[model samples]
Target: MRNILTLAGKDFRSLATSPMFCLIAALCSVMWSFTFLRSLILFAENTQATFNPGPSPTLQMTVFLTHISQINLLFVFIVPALTMRLLAEEKKLRTYDLLLTAPITATEIALGKFLGAFGVILILVALSFLYPLATYPIAHFSFPPLLAAYLGVILVASTYVAVGVFASSLTQSVVLSVVMGLVFNLFLWFLSQGAESATGLYMTSVLEQISIGDHFMAFIRGSIRLKSIMFLLSCTGLFVFLTQRVVESSRWR
Candidate 1:
């Protein structure tokens, strides 16, 4: 456990110091801030206009969060970029062998790297809460829905990290890892698209259930379904397990 935390801390520090992390974090912050401000202004204006009869503050805030969560789409590219170097760089620098032969087991190494990457993502997610928190004093919206949306975002981010780590384990080239990770993320994100064109009800149901976006929508709508939670968690665990297998294979090579 100590070894895992140590490795996770090292990877977290590594990512925290990188220039790419700074750029991505800044871009996301700016975009989210702008969106929040615009939405809030519009909500206030509509509320004051007698003819408008605008939505409730709670609903308006929920919509604002829904818009903010769209930033997760941007993470499809950002996460792969962030995770590309986790394992690929280790292989490129030829340090993977040293680690493989060290006291750490493959599972520990995979989980540690995952935790490191996840820690960085958590920072970005935390920053997102600032806007809502700042507005809460004036808006006084419900906490449950807001919390649920954040939960959805975290689960989606976890899935992204797991996929990114698995993709990173596949190759020594960081570029290849990014491409593989993006492809995997896109496939998972769009999995439900198949349901749209399907003729059979059962086939459509299966595709929708398998989609990462469908489950995420449930949380954004303020409904915490057990199946959705399990599905997202299952995806996270599945890829982490795949990453462990990939790392273990290095012992033979």
Candidate 2:
């Protein structure tokens, strides 16, 4: 346990010093900020023009949540960029052997790296709180929906980081890791889309269940479902387990 904490701390510090991490973080911040500002401008225009008596609290919440959902798409790219180098860099520099031979187990190494990367992503997401905070004055502003959306984003981000970490373990080149991660994410995204288009009712229902966007949409509307939480957690665990297996397999190489 102590070794794992030390390794996690070291990984966290290493990621902090990485120029790639800084560049990706800056890009994500800028993109999210721009999206948030645009939404605010549009909301201000809508609110100032007329007193639309028909705009209920539910409608307002829907609009705000949808806008937030759009902004979170940026995480799809940013997460892969952030995690692409975690294990790839270690393998590329042949330092993975040293770490593997140390007191730490593969599970500890994988989990530690995952936690460190996830911590960075959580901080980035937290920094975007200004978006919802700024909207409080303009809208009916229920905290439940906002909280749900943030939770959804964190789950999505954690899942992506796990996938990226597993991808990173598969290759020594950071570029390759990023490409692999993107491809995997893209496949899942496309599967969700394809499922939505299926002809059979039962098939579509299953597809909707598996759709990341579908689950996220529910949260955006401030509806916290246990099923969605379970799905996100399951995805996170699956990928993390896969990453551990990948790391362990490398020991025999």
After superposition on all CA atoms, what RMSD does each candidate show versus the true structure? 1.8, 2.2
lDDT value, residue 17 of candidate 2: 73
Write out the backbone clash pairs for model 2: none
For candidate 1, what is the TM-score?
A: 0.94
Best by TM-score: 1
Question: Compared with the true structure, what per-residue lDDT tens digits does model 1 show for residues 52-121?
Answer: 3564455424455556566688778888899999999999999997788899999999999999999999
In candidate 1, residue 150 scores what lDDT? 80
Q: Could you tell me every candidate's TM-score relative to the true structure?
A: 0.94, 0.90
Model 1 residue 240 distance off true place after TM-score fit, in angstroms: 0.3
Encode model 2's per-residue lDDT on 55-172: one tens digit a residue.
Answer: 5335236455655666566677778888888899999998998888897888998888888888888777777766677767756555876788788888888888898898999999
In model 1, pairs of residues that clash are none
